[model samples]
Target: MSGSESSAPAGQAAPEALSFTVHSMPQPSLADRRSRVLGGRLRLLLVLLACAAPVIASYFTYYVIRPDGRTNYGTLIQPSRGWPADLALQAIDGAAVAPAALRGQWLLVTVGDAACDASCEKHLYMQRQLREMLGRERDRVDRVWLITDGGTPAQALREAVEATGPVWMLRVDRAVLARWLAPADGQALGDHLYIVDPMGEWMMRMPADPTPQQVKRDLDRLLRASSSWDRAGRE
Candidate 1:
């Protein structure tokens, strides 16, 4: 009931400043801040590395421990070139063929006379057999027979090529064909099996008469090597 006693005077009501000592917050030096940031970044990097290790390890195991003794029947050409920009082609039906159409599949190409010489028959057989041996992956590889010299193949020769399996008997000009498929120093265009990759690049040239077994080995290794990225289909 005593307002004067309950309510202190304005001068007395003003609370005095507390006598507590002000302690400054400890400031981190630039080096300390950098160290913490570095530690956090290292931890994040370690997490990412852990996620990537299995895939990287799988590649390492396959490449390093799998005993890479596989060999190719084709002469392994170093630095093989892509299909020349100026290269021209003609299909068996005399229709103009574009080199760009060869992309998206492995091409096992052979050049030979339309007259079907003994050597040409052998190459054709090997090409068929090598492709057949690929099993499920056979469709991924195609056989392209470039009958050079512009000579029209006999009906029997065309029948024989068709009978072998899926073989393309394209009639290509010898001059243009030769420009695309350059033989070795002592070889001729019709003397070897030329390999063109999925990217339309002529990558390898096999011996004139490669054995079926030799060609098979080369294909197996190539398929295995490219399995991570390549698939069955045209470009």
Candidate 2:
């Protein structure tokens, strides 16, 4: 064997030495990791805010931007009550109506028995008139008659409702209806007209026997204020 080579077994090949190279990877700093996490959370928050912008802008217009400098005639419902998801409403034709489907337009709602007495008729008339008075803005409002009774509505009531073009005639349980809509002092739910915003929030209640002019003023203000965010029809 040469001096530089070590001898092994006479017939066996020599084994080669193994070599390894170590390379260290840099770990992210705590501040860098925290900044990345914070950036992701901030992005998620911004997306949520963007989704809620329309609702927030509408409310801001109603509460903050009073163009006419006149107070709302309808009593404002602070922290407005949202439409009940479990209402199980039914259309006049007995079709299932989803509460979510009622969103995306202003709602002028009236509650009463299927009989639709004189008071009910009067409120329905006012609802129709108020919507009509909006003229070009009329498409922005929807009239809803929530029949609390179970039986079929009276033929006269049905005919009257049909006369009001595109009115949403729906039936809801009286007990459930009461939980969402209320009347003024010494009055029934049938006495007042409820104002639901485009977002399905019951935000205002017109007084019992409200004057047409007064109700129009309130409706006008809402329509005008929400013009920036609210559109004419439901999505």
Candidate 3:
């Protein structure tokens, strides 16, 4: 037998085999990738809006759905001013307190000397009564007495303040306070009761020597307006 012819048995065939090649998918272009990312972001934003719809709708019902001619008892400060961060302030215990720390709740602020005269007592009384009138919502409003002078508050005044409930007795510079809380024309800061919103904007100012009934109406409106968003306490 010849060397090449004798390699396989007669009439026998070589085994057959099959093979395949795999091709990877093409990569996405930059524009396509950006569009996919934007689509995901839009979906996330839509979910957030759905979660916040109740709060947004409640505010819309109070502010936009109301009649255009309605008037508020308190004067709305045009171009609302925010609390000053740099103002020097201290608590009754002589501990330093940042002015901005007073945010996150409604504030009824009265500014005067530490001596606290009769007029000052009257203002403090009105503040306490107004908050108590709120019932369950009283926690949402805080009473703030900003003493502008260096003298410590009198013992009697301190006792009276404590009897009124929680009062944030903070001492601030007189000149610095004048820049933020202003009185009506022909009046002083002590003459008016200032209202600060939960977000720290000084939004309203009650008239000098305002009647409790009128102030109550204004506060009721505010509480109703903010019911959906403002909770009863700070963090």
Candidate 4:
């Protein structure tokens, strides 16, 4: 043994050569970069469609092809409309009502002056009957009477409206309302009962003096088709 080896500690051996592993850093080419981008986009698209599926399905069933294949009695509003952000709405007591408050339930809306004319009275009765006819599904719906002026409805009239179920009477500007709902050509806005979906979009407008039986058929189909959809109950 060499002199240095002999002088080393008893258990010590000569120094061994150090070894290292060399790895090539990943350098993605153009195709690899494109693939990654495409993958990310596809994932995003899938997520969006998943979130929108229920809404799309419900709307399609009502607007496009009904399962029973029967045409709707009410006129479908194409590219449905929502309450205008600037629309000034107030409760019966004149408290400000946020537009967001109107969302999250089916709204059967009626528009008229607070004087309770015959046409207005008939519509109020029809609204109640339509809701009652829904049976258990009645709980999923609500009635909104938009009074276009500052006048309060007669006590008897309000009582009649609430005799069966509560009606939301809000004072709204008639001009502002024109931006959210409209009537058939040559007809007044109060002449039609408007159907607003849970998302607050105006979806349907009843014919002038709509028949309860025909309207009931539409409501039945709507409630049936949307059985899967739900929201927080009656806020």
Candidate 5:
């Protein structure tokens, strides 16, 4: 082969190889690549932050703010606690129900048997009356009767309950009931009315004989406090 012929083949090969390499190994610009990485990191950070927000907010609200300044009517249960994991609860009509079902609405719960006494009746009356006093916001709260016994409720009791649309006659296991909402030294479960938040957490318990005015005040304060996060109903 001649010198010029060899040189031409070399030149042709060099350009062809260079073009092939350019097409084979495509690369993004520095700015575009950086932006993609940063965007992915930003999305991951946002997801982590979203998951942590509720715990952070609750700690901030409960610990940072001193309850000393606030005058609350209901005695805040010392060692504010929650229901047991295995809390056995049933429905009035013999169907099973869980504590989670109590979520999504404020619960005004009273523990008693179907054969209610004077105290039981009094608490029941208070529950209904207190809810009614909430006016337009009454529907946001539910009056729940945690009946420990399996005895069926009487027709008269049902009639009284029907008059109040927000009432629920629940049948919870007695042992589970005792585990939670523990009564005073001599008091029975039927004595006092307890307050449970919409989150299935038993937040507060009233005195054995909670006056209507006191309960109304407590309810008002709770409504005011939760107004920021909670709406009128579960939307």
Candidate 6:
């Protein structure tokens, strides 16, 4: 005991020593933790949406609400159909091509028997010319020949068609293909050329006998609209 404190406390009580009781910080409640998690999830979703905005906007502009009105020549398949997962596709060499491989490139698909009659030949010629017509944008488009019958194409016709860029020559079931793509009334399955986006969904179909220039115009619009998101090669 100090002398001052003892002397001062003769009649008065001594002062208590200064002291503190430590308390722990309050913990977060279950509800508060849940809210924090939800907030983090929402922020992640917003980031994803921001990344995909350009692609969504382009498709919306081209398909959903076209400001330029309906000047498109190709028949738009409303609610576009996806590439049939079960649809068996094979290369000319008899190697099976997985349906997933078709993704990541815009496809100009033409269907016909391997025999390739007059109308089929005409379509093939037009297909090549149209891609070429794209000029600098030609590499962005691929020419695909989906042979409906099991038979292989003639060497001469194959040589003629594949003279420039390589053509995706594949064999598929006629009946299976018919179920996926339909022609106009009174027209056969081989009448039209189908337009498939890079994601492998059939979006448009050309006329039974389409004008080259008009077809090119529709392609131009589609390519330009998707330019921001799409690239020239497969993934």
Candidate number of the best lDDT: 6
Q: Score candidate 4 by lDDT.
A: 0.88
Q: How many backbone overlaps does candidate 2 show?
A: 0
Q: Which run of 10 residues does model 1 get worst, by summed lDDT?
A: 55-64
Tens-digit lDDT track of model 3 for 68-157 = 656778888877788666678988788998776777788998888888888898999889899989888889999999999887889888
What TM-score would each prediction reach against the true structure? Answer: 0.68, 0.84, 0.79, 0.85, 0.74, 0.85
Model 2 CA deviation exceeding 4 Å by range? 1-24, 29-31
Q: Residues 1-72, candidate 1, lDDT per residue (tens digit)?
A: 657665767777655667988899999999999999999999999999987675455445444555555434
Q: Output the lDDT of residue 109, model 1.
A: 90
Error (Å) of candidate 1 at residue 205 is 1.2
lDDT of each: 0.76, 0.87, 0.85, 0.88, 0.76, 0.89
Q: 178-198 in candidate 2: lDDT tens per residue?
A: 778888889888999999988
* Candidates 1 and 6 compared by lDDT, better number: 6
Q: Compared with the true structure, what per-residue lDDT tens digits does model 6 show for residues 76-168?
A: 998888966579999988999887787888899898989999999999999999999999889889898999877999999999999888999
- Please give the ranking of all candidate structures by TM-score, highest first, separated by commas: 4, 6, 2, 3, 5, 1
Backbone clash tally for model 6? 0
* Candidate 6 Cα errors over 4 Å, as ranges: 1-27, 64-67
Give candidate 3's error at residue 23 in angstroms. Answer: 4.3
Error of 5 at 19 (Å): 6.8
The stretch of ten residues in a row with the least summed lDDT in candidate 3 is: 58-67
Error of 1 at 204 (Å): 1.2
Candidate 6 to truth, TM: 0.85
